[model samples]
Target: MSKPLEQNFVELLEQHQNIVHKVCRLYTNNYDAHNDLFQEITIQLWKAFPKFRGDSKFSTWMYRVGLNTAITLYRKSKRTINTQQFDTVQFKISAEEYDSTEEDQLKLLYNAVHQLNDIEKALVFLYLEDKNYKEISETMGITEVNARVKMNRVKTKLRTILNP
Candidate 1:
């Protein structure tokens, strides 16, 4: 890439870097993994930047590419499957009985979301970010109706996971 193009890319990335960070957070649990995934996403973006035309907003395009990269990596990587055994019978602290703060609920929600597959995580992330179905569909290259249906399914799955 030309210096001007490189500089422009840097500026745009710097401006919208939080998008990448959010993607990293959704995909990774630890700080090192988060940084590595962010770097990989940045590298992928840099490699594809030369082919970018202004057909869509840069941010929207970034989401598509970032999500695709994450989904691909997630499919290929061999993460350690949890090996510890857990007791089936546990103490009961019901939501109504326990005075949980908003942050506590947020943490629980994030933990549940972390258990989702990459594609489901992308959908949930986009939905949580308040993106409309049209935007989600465009970002994921799915039909708007499909996006809505998938999101509904994801919501139901989240409810089950969080509740169970």
Candidate 2:
């Protein structure tokens, strides 16, 4: 990488570190794998950085790339490795106080989402991250209607898992 591009790369990482970390955490529950995937995603982003235009917000573009990398990179294996050694990292939330019930519910939701198929998990990830149908469709290269339908199915599946 050229000096200017290297500086830009570091700046991008500094600005969007959370996005990459979140993708790694969600895609690979194991810390070692998560770190490896994180590195790989960063490399992928750097490689693809040249194609990025300033038309969209940087976070939006980063989300698209990171989500795509997470989904495609980790979809090969279906086995759940033990994550006992992985430390539960805290996220930066605006609230001054933490709600254990809400945290537990979120954990339960992620656990159930973990049980979904690759495609379903992708949809769930985008939905949980508050991505709109259009963005999700663009990222996944599917129709907006398809994104809505998939999200609806994922919600139903999650409800069943959480309730049952």
Note the Cα lDDT for every prediction shown: 0.82, 0.77
Residue-wise lDDT of candidate 1 within 1-164, one digit each (tens)? 58999999999999988889888777766667778989999999999999999788898989998889877887788573221112221223454654557547866777788777778889999888888999999999999999999999999999999898
Q: What is the TM-score of each candidate against the true structure?
A: 0.85, 0.84
lDDT of 2 by residue, 26-124 (tens): 777766787898898898889888888867767777877887887777655656533322227555765456577776776777778777776787777
Q: Which stretches of candidate 1 lie over 4 Å from their true place?
A: 80-100
Number of clashing pairs, model 1? Answer: 0
Model 2 lDDT, residue 32, Cα: 79
**Which of the numbered candidates is closest to the native, going by highest TM-score?**
1
By summed lDDT, the worst window of 10 consecutive residues in model 1 runs over: 81-90
Q: Please identify model 2 stretches exceeding 4 Å from their true place.
A: 81-87, 90-96
